[model samples]
Target: MKRELVRNREVGIKSGRSASYYFALWSISAKLVMDFFVPARDLNFFVFNGLLVALFLLLRPRLYLGRRGVALFVVASTFFAALALKDGGNSIIFKIASLPVLVVVFFSIGRGLSEAAVKRLFKILFVEFIVCFLLNYVLSVATGLIRSREFWNFEHANLLGSYVLVMLVPTSYLLYQLSNSKGRIIGFVLVLMAYLSTSTGAFLLSLSVFFKAKNLAFKNIMIILLSIIFVIIAGLALLSIADPMTYDKIAAPFKLINSGGWDRLVGEARNGGGITYLAADQQGSFTWRAYAYLVYGFFIAGETWDRFIFGNGVGGYEIVWGGAMPHNDFILILTDFGFLFFIVWVSFCGWLLVKVWREYPQWFAVVVAFIFRLLCENNIYSYYVASIGCVIFSLIFGAITRASRERGAVRAQASRAVA
Candidate 1:
């Protein structure tokens, strides 16, 4: 009896040690996923490679090689093959291929997380968001004399704002799942951080869409909207007090709006073609973007019948004026590849949307938060955007997939018991 008890104690100790090892790997992998926005070269490279090694060590084919997961893999493999076949030596193929691998890594890691583990991940991300926000605010305050947008060494203020906004989707969702008070408080804090970056896209979506209102009544809706407008005004007022020049920098992109010059925006674009046409407005910092979006619309309108059907071909984004995106995903995808590829890509996205939504249709607000960004910024073709997009989407898919599997297993177990 003593020998049996000793053996049982040894087994329990081994299990405890194994769990600690598993969690150490999980925490490191999750942190690497969280830090994709920090633009330190060797650090990201090390963390990313370290993540891959950890993933390889922790891989379980049963989790990823299942029916729905395999279906996703097949779709991704097909898209990669298609991109490779059409690569005209432009670097789109590399970006295209790397996305799914990143998604798979996150998915593999996230799939194994228990509820407690998932909550711990959220707290880590919550801390990360606050830290980055403080860093960006400090740097912007310190460097106010030099730069228009302070990115805290990421890609761009707007892009980083978008990243933070994306992080808020899962952050808010996870917190909401835990408790409403926690969700509302943290959600507001995050939105305030995003607004400080002056990313109109993030501001619009994160506040107007993701954050919750008290009720569904029209009065509540109006109050929430008015409250948001008030907070924005108040926030900018505070920013102006801290640094008027920084406020000016934040407000420059909207000088057209104050002047009621949106009508003038279209005339600027139709002035000529290409980058020169967009850059015609010497007085306007943002008129060029307005000009470019209009130009892309015209270019799409002028596509040859065959080109319109198939896209300009893969890597065909080079033909874009100076090869920069119109800061629109639909325009970027449709123009580079063609209507068909764009449709396929969009349809697959729609499927994920439906799958995710079916799990909880209320989650559509979180999904639309990023969709709003897609309308106003460079889409997943960007490295930062791709990394942020993959981590969030894969986490949702992984979590949902795990729940689905557990339900199936429970049902199977019941069936076996009945038999």
Candidate 2:
């Protein structure tokens, strides 16, 4: 593993070279709005990210095609195969648009960074991004350039808030490991402020998930979470009773991410549906919404043999939804490429999850948090999300490789002793 680490340096792979590192840096720089600052499919995304992927692969070509890698290949090939059988410009366009994210997947497979190395990289990005957020907030206030519901350059406040988890989960976990209680508290607060700035349901949900990590005990976390929930409910109840108008104003921010929080509770409809959300909102849960939408879309796409099995290919969801973006990765993926692609990708993701749990049980919580976000968001289609996934998977894969190398070293020592 040390030899691999040295080789990484020989190939110019630094902490700054990681795709996940750039996901944080580029997102922070997004306010500049220049093509150079953009992290999407821009030249910079191509040049630097591509260079990073290239160097890592150059050092360890063997890491390029593990079981997970093969699964992704099968998925990508299925997409192209779907495109070939279908007739539409959108299918071609979708394929082209997805290529950059595919490259991100390559980066993950190319660099099998050990668990410690991955944690270190994540911590560095966490501190740097939080510092930038503080400085940017101050500067934006001074200049009065900050727009309402906008944090940094994210057009959607939820994206900014939830994205902070990419840093927060790892930083908190690291602090817990290092026994730096004060540092952990400060990092949690800073990250929480960034998260609450948007008050997005998904971001809040991610925070709740973070509590279950190894850093915190189950009983303590349950007590803390239950107490918070109780307070929020009591406050809303009192506000509603005391001043309806003031209550509306106070709950306005909360309602932005969700249409109705407490109001729905007070209404008679609460007991009617087991799921409390709008049928359209999937009860403000991406998993529920995606499941509901996909069932409907499958029928809409038709039960024809080929269509049912292979789907209408990429962009077929528009035919089902009248051109609205699916806004759910599962539904969008399943409807576009059908059962084959969806199954392969999900299986690969499941394998990665198991590997993470097996290798670094401490990080299982962090993995769960991000998986929830991925389920709720169209991260599968987002390049930034792809980069985040790539970096995370690399850690587990790297750790696996490290373990294998250690076993081999022990065997070599035994053989030499026998001589």
Candidate 3:
């Protein structure tokens, strides 16, 4: 009877392990496909996140739960509570509904980061980006759809372009780390294709790669300089042929591009009558609610403090901004939750940045892209934002955890040897 029982336990363990391996693969593949092809859809988040959560719960006994994990839970709870209160109970209820999905995202990232796995995953991503971009472009041109603005309306293309651009720096760095001729050639070709796509974000991302690689080889600098020169020359040629009315139409956007931060802020403040000029002849509401939250938090204390600490909750921004998410993530946190939550959120970002720097410095391009995008888009609370955030956070946490374990093992070995 004892022998039979032991056999049953062993079989259970083996089955569990096998299930986990398949689950991890499924989660990673789903994430990649969603990221590339269906990024704008909420359903992708639901499917991927559901799988991730199931895997985590099933494997929790074997997973490490540490300080960071505890902190994450606390932060999530505060945000969840804030959402509930802000939305008149609906926000909280929705967050509860979504909790399982968030867990899956967290676990999926954690499970996918073995060193060999990281390299393999990146290689596949690089290939996919190339193939997808080519196919999209070819289809667009062959169908005579390339000239239509509707061709650019596919949100997935924009998202993928942004992803490639944001990842270019890190991808290049990975190539350098691999230090193989084939890796370098493939990386270069991928970057070249990304640039040819003329996705503004991707082009900017390529600049990041140039700066990162410039010190190692003058060739990077030369390529960047040539690209800039070519763009300028092309612009001049177009301008020379453009009608005066066309030139006039384009000049307003140019003025906005040239307006510095302080000038824009001052203009917004002076024109506070529910409208401000974003560019010449282009006007919209320019309320600086984010600035208001920061200043208010500094002045208020107590349950005003709870509001400051926990945030008004998820949809709290709507109360202050008339149904608009705060453009600044920092302000979004302060207004929605409060100062305490804001500080913790910022601290988490700092910790994640350090981890990425230590283990995957090249991936910093994506971080930069996120920051750049945030200047114009309130991405932090969006479904896509949450998915990307959870994945990256899980990856960093896993890397940090593994490093700590390895260090402890090394120290233990040395101590025993000395004894």
Considering lDDT, where higher is better, how would the candidates rank from best to worst? 1, 2, 3
Candidate 2: what lDDT?
A: 0.53
RMSD of each: 6.0, 7.8, 7.8
Better of 2 and 3 by lDDT: 2
- For model 1, the stretches where C-alpha displacement exceeds 4 angstroms are 1-50, 58-62, 136-146, 208-267, 271-290, 313-315, 352-357, 404-419
Candidate 1 lDDT score at position 178:
62
Writing each residue's lDDT as its tens digit, candidate 3 over 1-419 gives 99996676446444433333344445655665565456355567567767666766765424445586667667676656555555654433463536534554445444434444445555655565567656666766776756652232234333444445534533664665576777567666756765555444354455555334213236865775797789756764675486333333334344444555445544443433232434433222122443333333333333464566566666667765357454556666667657776787678677766655665555554555555555433545545434554554454445435545667799999999999
lDDT of each: 0.63, 0.53, 0.52
The 10-residue segment with the lowest total lDDT in model 1 = 276-285
Q: How many backbone clashes does candidate 3 have?
A: 17
lDDT of 2 by residue, 64-100 (tens): 4558657766776665655755554543444344453
The number of the candidate with the highest lDDT is 1
Could you tell me how far off, in angstroms, the CA of residue 337 lies in candidate 2 after the best superposition? 2.0
TM-score of 3: 0.61
Give the Å shift of residue 31 in candidate 1.
6.2
lDDT of 1 by residue, 229-342 (tens): 898899789977986655664565476556666566666556544334222233332455666788787778887999888777655666756676677777787987688878
